[model samples]
Target: MSKPPSPILDLSHTGLLIAAHGSPSTKGGRTSSRKHAETIRNLGLFADVRAGFLTEKPFIKDVLDGIHLPEVYVVPNLAYRGFVSTTKLPQALNLTGEVTERITPNGHQRVHLCDPVGTDPSTAKTFAVRILSTMDSLKVPDTDTAIVVIGHGSGRGRESFEHTNRIARDLSRFGIIPPVFTTFLEEPPFIKNWRDLTRAKNVIFAPYLISDGFHGSEEVPRDIGFNTKSEIFIERLSHVQPNEMNQDGQRLIYLPPLGDAPEMAELIINRVRASLT
Candidate 1:
């Protein structure tokens, strides 16, 4: 017996709009979102693919207004299903629910709103691969190493904190790496207090964010004990071999955000495909 052919995905009649929380001061946020759109555009699945931001030019509202496709899918390119993804983005797009239909110049239009990429069940697995690869490159062993997954926790709701902790827990259960810890910029057990959370000799800081925006590029580095005088400073650190610091034999390694990860494009596509079902 032979394996059956894989199912074909066709969305030639639909348009995709990636809604993101952009930063005017940092280019990484908008740049990553547009990069994802470009990656998906080359695949030619959707009739059109474009990225829109909340705090940048070509805003979400304008992008939605320009799209005239019979069907549209709005996927929030956010890290967590927090206020930005579930509330701000939806309100900007005027979405009533998961599926919103309205009369427009293009006749009857249907729009599907997808959950944030980070909320996908497979996200934890993708994240694990990145962490394992990073560790392999550093020649670091799982013993005596603590992994801290940091997120931009929200005060408005517990969604951000909950999702971050869940991902951290899931990563820990994999047993491939050392103990995984959850920290945040806007919540308790903050990134600045990593020493208080765990006692691992070697520490790895992984940012659980979509992009190296204000939080990732600026706050993360500062919290992890680096001088973030400019956004480009963090980029330079990423290129440094062993991007770690030694203090009395203890080591601290900082990993970049997941925005540039190749797996992210797949995660976005999975979110869109799930909406179709």
Candidate 2:
């Protein structure tokens, strides 16, 4: 089979805006976004790199208005093209759909909206890397580890689950981790019943979602009995000092969500660049 074309593009003179669905209580949101912005800025690929969010400061319109560049590319820091990416984000940015022309003080700025980070094909590698890196960080062996990819599935929509399935399929084919299984919070194949899904003595449960917010940080842990409550986002992984925790005779590691991780910057950049083509 032929390889796919490179997603990187000549993004010179174009500003990059990473669009994220920020949380009011997520202290890491700004920090993570700033780190990604700095990382992309350090690359010197574009005129500038900034984060514009739907629920936080330096919001989409504000960030868009602040930029003096002639063009800007907005990449959704999302896991899928659900209502957020497809409707809310674009609507917030004043986009008719994909490309929206914004009237800045200097002149009309051309804004190109890229698909969410989760929609990219490269995320599968990111997922694999996240799982492996978590294992390495915790000094856990790769022996009989059931790598569980968790998505913030919707009970009402198929789009989120569909993209998740594709990504999971791609990740499985990569063979980075044997027996890569996928589950969701809202949908079937629930995270609570992961043990029944696979017989691997060890497990690494990873959230396929973008943020370290409520879903990944609180809800997931609560659902999986890793936490007592889902009311607050824990500073790090829930109620564990040793990287790997023993849950019902199974060694499990709960990996952080993709949004807060630094590795996500590469995937964001790729999605932004891919939008140019």
Candidate 3:
């Protein structure tokens, strides 16, 4: 089938810059961001598409300097609209607000700062799609499965925890799957208590994280009794790992972070488009 035309028009000179929170210890986060940027680039909707990181090479400032486009939309690839999206990103890009007009060495450029892609309610739809798809592949009925979304909630503020809980609430409302739960690494009802929190025989762990890195590959698994601290960290080969493990009389299926979802490229585009109007 032919691909649908893009919603926005006349973007021959427009550009997209995905500002991501890079992982210094692992390349997974940077790789995920670049893949999303490439996916959007393939759509032929913009003159340029690039991913820049905060903790890695080709940093945000460098990427911004390299872009010569007259208009660029900066979208935070983070899973939450907390400190990084609201303060760190804008400060790094020298943006004062949603729209910032600045004169760069390359030329005069107009920067449009957009909300983090995770802030989009449709992101919950993406989560639902991923969860249901994984369940179908595993032959695990939704009725018997429990979705536990794990996030790194902060003690400093409620934004991180609230964002994760919101996704859980949204998934619950979808009614496609029963018994969705939320847990955090830094806050109450922590991930270590996942098994005790649900009664389902099959538990699917959806990391509400932008980048899987050490959290998804190691910490979460260890916390949930799937792996030991000494176990080798497995890099994600796909969105859903084919090997499901049996843990304490229950089936455990862990998925890659939300940013790695195939729908993310389109989601980023939508967020950028929304900023235009």
Candidate 4:
């Protein structure tokens, strides 16, 4: 009875699940989840790390059923949209308005669900790092570039859009760069208005989504006049080739969705650890 030093945790008996509301049309979201799950599994953190989805094959219930451990942890792999974080995940996992759902088989299976992992304030720092790195790669000074944190703002979940703004504000206050903007695909001050509203000559666009699916990669880029092919967006983390683009008078830099970044995998691990306390 000694704990493995690899994961550095005594949760060898536990199974970890990274849960996402996967895309039905595009495999990007689910594929990213599986990639991250594999990354976590390589870390030897739990008995197993599995990706579960609400819309794709290998559904949440399927993974839940397959995990034959007494303690199972499910981390919501979402951007903290009110719908998915509050309603969809709970309903799909059959929590019945509880923090966890218990099932008794041989002894018992205690399934603990964690909150939205991507939209946590901790990710603000990660976003800042990504922006800085992108700026460095483009040879653009951080102070000279404005950052816009983009989201698929939902009117049904106004809180989700507000959270996007909060991340932008945090990035601004944290001094990643001044002139931070928050815009969306489905709401006001949208992507089309990026040039009109933003004060900087160069802008770094960062996605505040779980995956670079249809919206983040293709739809958003197309709206911004990049006009990339839809098929390429499905598997790409960074949609626009060559990173930076010159749009007449202004410069545009696209950063991959946070969910696709390695930092996000670390954040997911942190989320699972947080649930332990």
lDDT tens readout by residue for model 3, 95-200: 9899999998878999999989998868888888888887777788867878889988988789999889888888865555568889988898899998778968
Q: After superposing candidate 1, which stretches have Cα over 4 Å from the reference?
A: 1-8, 28-30, 173-175, 230-233, 237-242
Candidate numbers sorted by TM-score from highest down: 3, 1, 4, 2
Q: State TM-scores per candidate.
A: 0.90, 0.85, 0.91, 0.88
- C-alpha displacement of 49 in model 1, angstroms? 0.6
- Tens digits of lDDT, candidate 2, 18-50: 888877766743445666777878877788788
Residue-level lDDT of model 4, residues 1-277, one tens digit each, is 1222334368767898888878776665345687788887886768888998888878998888888888888888888747887788788878765356576565678888776787555788887777777776678876666877788788686886888888777875545755788889888879878876776778778888776467766677777766466444433444323345678777877767777776677778777777667
Residue 254 of model 3, lDDT score: 76
Candidate that beats the other on lDDT, 2 or 3, i.e. the better one: 3
Whole-model alpha-carbon lDDT for candidate 1 = 0.80
> Who is ahead in TM-score, 2 or 4?
4
Q: Which segments of model 3 are wrong by more than 4 Å?
A: 1-5, 28-30, 228-243
Q: Quick one: best TM-score, which candidate?
A: 3
3 or 4, which is superior by lDDT?
Answer: 3
